[model samples]
Target: MKTKKLNVKSRTENLSLIRDFVSSSAAEAGVTSDVIENIILAVDEACTNIIKHAYKSYPDGELIVKTKSTRNRFIISITDYGKSFEPDAIPEPDLQKYYRQKRVGGLGMYLMKTLMDDVKYVSIPGKRNEVQLSKNLKLTQQNVR
Candidate 1:
């Protein structure tokens, strides 16, 4: 297993950097391009939510991202010191209603859930919040050849 970590301020501008890190890490792990894109999107959404909700009042708050990979799986853990949140508490959006009402928000968590193989959230009150997103690399690797 290989592990890498990145720490950045909770600012939107740093999303690109995070995306690039995920892309490179995924590619190096022999993940397919399609899966790589999914991982990137999921991580992006998770970070965006942290910046927008958890650290809403603290732009300078720290956001720590840790990535670990094995032969069959790739996992990313994002940690923030801002307010904690319960991801499972957010009900799935009603697509029909959203389209009818032309709603723009409330899609981040949905996308994260749909794109990654597993999503887990751990919140410790006023201490820390961690969101983990994992992707299965076995199937993607099987399709490589």
Candidate 2:
């Protein structure tokens, strides 16, 4: 397995840096372009949640994003020391409801689950909150079906 890690402040401005890091790392690991895009989107969503919800937009909060890649798998682990929430508590998105309520947002979790083969969350109270997003490197968009 090959591993790479990045530590960035939990700010909206750093989301692009996170995406770039993940994108280049996945490409170097030989992940397909389609899979790489999926991984990038999932990672961006995960980090955005960490910055907005966990860190509550505090610019000083730290975000640790680590990538571990093997022949068949690419995994991104994001850690935050701010706040943690229950992943299961989030309900499946209802697009109609959002349209009716004129609400935007709340789709990051849903998007992550849709784009990644594995989406896991671990929260240790008063410790850290981690989100692990992974995809099978061997699969292409067509192979996914």
Candidate 3:
């Protein structure tokens, strides 16, 4: 597997950098454009969530973006050492209530789950919070899908 890690500050200045890294990594791995887009979108959603929620209180920690790729799969894990949040506890974004309440937020996680093939979160109190995301790309005619 090919792997790379980047440290981002609180300002979200590394969003484009993250996207570029994902795109280049996927392209080199021969991933299709559609698959690459999906991975990038999912990763972006996760990173955005961490920046906006996890580090919202303390803006001094680093947001770790790690990208890993194998022959048939790509995994991106975003780790934050800020507040502990368990993704499992997030209520299914009650879209019905959202529409009735006319709220404009709370859809990042929904999109992440929809776009990524696998999404899992692990939170350790006073330790670390990590969300591992993955996607499987099949090869078609000697090329990645």
Candidate 4:
């Protein structure tokens, strides 16, 4: 499968671009509308985090979004050139505590992790950080619509 790459600056419009690409890719993969909505929401949250946290600290780097499709699956990789972040190290959001204190910052990553079936992260020594997400298409008769 060939991957689709999109390069955009850290701006609000790019978020929409990323969501559209991901959602369209999901539809092309024959995923149902519900699954497609999940994909869009997950991708949107990831992109928003990059804009707000990743590139927000540094105003010079561009965000990269790569979308790939297989016969029965779809993958989207978001790469940013800002400071390195360890997604694995982020502690799961304490829902109980947040429900009481109303904290922020970790919920976006939590939502992304929950919505996607597979999420992987790789940070090079001095290069950009990459987050790879994979989605498997369900083949039930009800899901084909």
Candidate 5:
């Protein structure tokens, strides 16, 4: 397995850096373009939530992003030292209601869950919160020409 890690301030400007890292890591893992794009989007959504929600009131907090790949899978893990969030507490958005109300926000978590093969969250009170997103590279690579 191969792994890479990055640490950045919990700010919006750092999103591009995170995207680039995820893209490169996914490519290295032999993930197809479509899968790589989805992985990037999922990671971005997770990080954005960490920055905008978990670290909302603590701008100086740090976010640690880790990318790992094995023979069969690619994974991205994001950790934050801010307010922990319970993944189960976030209900699946009702798309019909969202569209009827013309809501613009509250879609990040939904996108993350839908885009990645597996999404898991772990939060330790007063310690840290970690969100893990994984994609099965074997399946994705098999689709490549």
Candidate 6:
């Protein structure tokens, strides 16, 4: 298993840097461009959510991004120390309602689920919040609709 870790402050401006790290790591695993793109987008969404929700846009919180790749899959784990929430509590997106309300946000989790083969969340009170995303090396279209 190949592994890499990035420790950076949770700031909106650092999203691009995070993307670049994911891109390079995925490329190193020989992931195709299409799959790599999806993985990148998913990671971006995860980090964005951390910055906005977990860190509450404070910009000074710590964010840890870890990557591990094998012959059959690629995995990304994002951790933060600011806040935590139950993943099951998040309702599925109501796109029509969002459109009617002119809401352009609130779809990060949905988008991450759609773009990755697996998405997992963990929160340990007084410890940290982590979101793990993985992409199978053999997936075609995503499983989620």
Superior candidate under lDDT, 2 versus 5: 2
TM-score of each: 0.90, 0.93, 0.88, 0.86, 0.90, 0.91
| TM-score of candidate 2 against the unseen true structure | 0.93
RMSD values for the candidates in order, in angstroms, are 2.5, 3.6, 2.2, 2.9, 2.7, 4.8
- Leading candidate by TM-score: 2
lDDT for each of the candidates?
0.89, 0.89, 0.82, 0.80, 0.87, 0.89
Q: What tens digits encode model 1's per-residue C-alpha lDDT throughout 5-89? A: 9999999999999999988988877788888989999999999999999998467999999999887889999999998897767
Please report how far candidate 3 places residue 37 from its true position, in Å.
Answer: 1.2
Q: Give model 3's TM-score versus the native structure.
A: 0.88
**Residue 3 accuracy (lDDT) in model 4:** 67
Model 4 residue 134 CA deviation in Å: 0.7
Better of 5 and 6 by lDDT: 6
Residue pairs whose backbone atoms clash in candidate 4 = none
Model 2 gets an lDDT of 0.89
The per-residue C-alpha lDDT of model 5 at residue 10 equals: 91
Q: How many clashes show up in model 6?
A: 0
Stretches of candidate 5 exceeding 4 Å from the true structure: 100-102, 139-145
Give the better candidate number (1 or 3) by lDDT: 1
Task: Write the number of the candidate with greater lDDT, choosing between 2 and 6.
Answer: 6
> Over the full model, what C-alpha lDDT does candidate 5 score relative to the true structure?
0.87
In Å, residue 94's CA in model 2 sits off its true spot by 0.4
Q: Which stretches of candidate 4 lie over 4 Å from their true place?
A: 57-60, 140-145
**Between candidates 3 and 5, which one is better according to TM-score?**
5
* Per-residue lDDT of model 2, residues 1-145, tens digit only: 8899999998999999999999999888878788888888889988888888888999999899999987678999999999887898888889999999886666988999999999988999899988898887665565356
- lDDT for each residue of candidate 3 in 51-127, tens digit (9 for 90 to 100): 87888835677888888888778888888887888776777788889999997456888888898888999999788
How much is the lDDT of residue 54 in candidate 5?
93
lDDT of 4 by residue, 55-102 (tens): 774545688888887766778899988767778677899989888987
**Ranking according to TM-score, highest score first:** 2, 6, 1, 5, 3, 4
> Looking at model 5, which ten-residue stretch has the lowest summed lDDT?
136-145
